[model samples]
Target: MTPKLKEDAQRLVIYIGESDRWRGKPLYAAILETLKAEGLAGATVIRGVAGFGAHSHIHTAAILRLSEDLPLIIHVIDTPEKIEHALELVRPMVREGLITLEDVRVVRYTHRYLNPLPADRLVEEVMTREVETLSPEMTVAAAWQKMLETLIKAMPVVDNSGQVLGMVTDEDLLERAGLQQRLSVAERLDKPLLDEEIARLRQSPLRVADVMSKPPITAQAREPLGLAAMRMAKHGIKRLPVLNDQGQLMGVLSRVDILRLLSEKPAMKMTAPLGATQTVRDVMTPVIPAVQQDDELPEIVEKLLESGTHRVIVLDGFGKAIGLISDSDVVARIQPSQRRGVIAALFGDALAPSSSVTAAELMSPGVLTARPETSLVQAARMMMNPKRKWLVVVDEQDKPLGLVDRHILLRALTAG
Candidate 1:
């Protein structure tokens, strides 16, 4: 738990000699390390020009008579409980020194420049309060309806007490049961086919507990947003169920929520030169999947499958991105008869055969583009539109250089 300072705080002052040693190390340094390990708010060490101790021997830093044992004072301020705890651990470390404790008022405390990004913000400030959760006994069909209504790819499974048991994602439904397609593809499906899919799910006896991933990863509402973002990136998850001290679900935190915060703040003015600071080129993934404009539908699907991505960029004869192809675009634009087979092929059910439908016929022409020198915040602002996801970094000739998505930006933001 993080220690907080109230109107009344305790200030601990320790006076020792610079030459004092603790287990072959400086006493002042040892005391500071101990306080830090104990999680005190903070500590500061100051060296005095001249001072006298119990022996009445004065130590001075005068040019003519420089003393080896200069007086040092360590200052620590925090709540009374924390100061008392620290005193117990630090008292034994000092063989001979003067320690004093007093009441003090804290005017203000801040850690503005500690991080390159605005990581000091709290999780509760940005987490989604009205999280859509699933019950353990709920049927798979019921969970699907809730997900479709909220447009959420994943949801937390909880019991009557709202304690999260696990997580259920669209992939869980398709893999655990015989569900035909993902939620996105299912939404694009025809009315009768969608009804049929739901009916198929309703026939199964599987409940949310049967499909949810157990031992859910979670975050605390009081923790820093940066810590939560790091957990998300490390686990390769898009969102986390935020919980309170009692382990009850309070909200949900997603990668978009963090990026949205970045979008609203001013550009972080790092100390590095303008050109030396981070940019699209610093974190983007090069060698992205691409398809030619005249490429057939089968070739485009092959590109998506091989690259393990949901979309592919379509380039013109001059090697410039003209449009983009996504699974949704294919399902929405292609003939109804071929939709089932294409969806199957996309999820690795089978390889989709070649067809006369050209990439030009199914691609969305307005492709989002960026430059190598674009700042991460600028790229984040461009992707705020719900319709845009991928930002293709291009060269002067408008050719592809790399790709930047929410995942990439989130990783960059959490990086030290």
Candidate 2:
């Protein structure tokens, strides 16, 4: 969404000849640039095929006079103050043309007419101030515990002087400390197995500096939020450490923070046209990973493995989503003896044997769903529930159409 212009506005029309020049550049081009540089609401340049000027000389795009100076009209509409400012700046450039002004009504304005992300919004406005930072001297064991307690997947490693040294993530711990699963999955492990994993970390001499990724990518607190979002997307990172002008750590900005900005005022009235508003269908991944409701446990595991995702949507006979089967669900719902084999199969150690058990018996029923036309903000609010990571986009018949997860939603907002 974008801010709308007042209904009472002014339209400035400048009539000029294509042959006219301003400092070796086209007069209309120079004027248009000046108006744009002045921050005018909007402008358009339309070249006429055939027309005549005040001199009464005819100009046409006919074969004989194809290079004749065609009439170009520069159209602009904005607030009264902006339009007046533009007229004052550009009027002097049109030495031999006409300029007209008239009152016009602004029927609508949307992101289609402007930038989707507000350029005026600063990074500090949305960044999390009370960031859970890690010290470079902290041991891997200590850092891991901090991440688990804070539920933060990524944390910036800083020095005693508050200078950012590097970044440590859950993936780094998993790779460097021989962890068997992600932080989320590890949290659900039994006490004995969890203690065994912790003991392995305690035995290692690795510190945050040893495992953290150095030369950290960061954003300035004063930079535009849009630019920071772009930096995250360009680097394919989940979050960035925000720093002040002094080069000291200030805060952190994550994908979740950017997504929350989209729905900051969800209840605010949306005045944009229907086509201008983004919907689930605009960003959802159409290729959904799914399995039949009656699929055997082995088949479900195969689908999960093939999809390279933690969860798979379960569909009924009519291809309607009814439930979901996640890796955690498999470990929690299945018999104790089958858990090891299922986990091993998911890691491609071996394929689980087909059993009479069906997906319907293992899957968590009543999945979250959204329609193709559901607004992006609405989708965000619905996904605010901590347990709802993915939203199954469905048709009117409740059949699966696509999938919308946190990453996809974040990508859409960042793209703005």
Candidate 3:
């Protein structure tokens, strides 16, 4: 139970019958609608996978099962005062099932706002603008180097005009390399024309465009985080690029940035709703860590984690964000042999692996970037749509700046 649960407020669990003949749809809808009308904070409905109660019968193996046989669970969290008021109407009508009450603690809560004002807020006040980027012409070697130098898992690929072309990820690079390695030995030993095949493999040209994912998704600097999260969930992406009104790249956003903003202690209390008076700049992490576009993966990882942070920004020689690297990127680059060796060391073997892997072996060359003044809400939306956890802050020159996490935004909201 959450310690914050108002003594007068209680968490309620209401179970209803699952008979197909009964008004199941109406009942479920009524329960939810009533809860909302009564102004309860929130309610959840769970459909049972398989279970039976009071009837004492096994209920599986049915093709066209009706509503009566199905099970429904309803849970509502709110102040005891609200619960009791709503229960007054619920208790009389619900006669057959179970109605229980419990005390619990809510780690965080937010006051719902109906009509929020926007004048006091601007996108820049909350958007994270620092970012990293990558180019399409870089090789696997150069991409890997950038990852090591920046410590980001994925990078946005963009063109000279500052428009995003696509996105490249560490996973994509490693998967390609691993597949090539698997084919190498087989072709070398099993084929009668091994020499010819080897020559072809060596001569093969690898370009960023060959491996990059195109048609990148983007967000405006004024969009809200809630909408951003919905887009991310629907599209199954990890990050979104932030763009200005002119469609110029401004920054990148990831899930971690949103989480950083939401998880902060100050935002936990129900007060003004998020985005009421906030802007992207107000919540963005300003001091971005970055690496050159030509750097390698090993170096990117080293520098990204040097400050004990999990991510870093990538930039070109001129200082624009080219991409980002994260702990997950590093993990993706590890080979089975390396994993075994690292595990062996955990069991007391003191010797380190002999190979000297460089960042150029692990990073993606192309990167996506954003402007420093982009809105935090828009950034969060982009991160959620793409399912990414980090974003790079950058300048107009496309130079890498800082990194932002979702949690930071949530914190700012709570504090404000």
Over all chains combined, what TM-score does candidate 1 have?
A: 0.73
Report the lDDT tens digits of candidate 1 across residue range 307-361: 8778899999999999999888888888898887888888788878668898889
Q: Provide the overall lDDT of each model, using Cα atoms, as 2-decimal numbers.
A: 0.84, 0.81, 0.57
Report the lDDT of model 2 for residue 43.
Answer: 85
Which one wins on TM-score?
1
Better of 1 and 2 by TM-score: 1
Writing each residue's lDDT as its tens digit, candidate 3 over 308-396 gives 55556665566665556554444445564564343232222333344455444445544544566655555556556665656666666
For candidate 1, give the lDDT.
Answer: 0.84
Minimum summed lDDT over a 10-residue window in model 1 is located at 108-117
lDDT of 2 at 295: 88
Report how far residue 298 has shifted in candidate 3, in Å.
Answer: 26
Off-target runs (Cα >4 Å) in candidate 2 are 1-70, 74-119, 266-270, 350-356, 385-387
lDDT assessment of candidate 3: 0.57
| Over 4 Å off, model 3 | 1-124, 177-204, 265-416
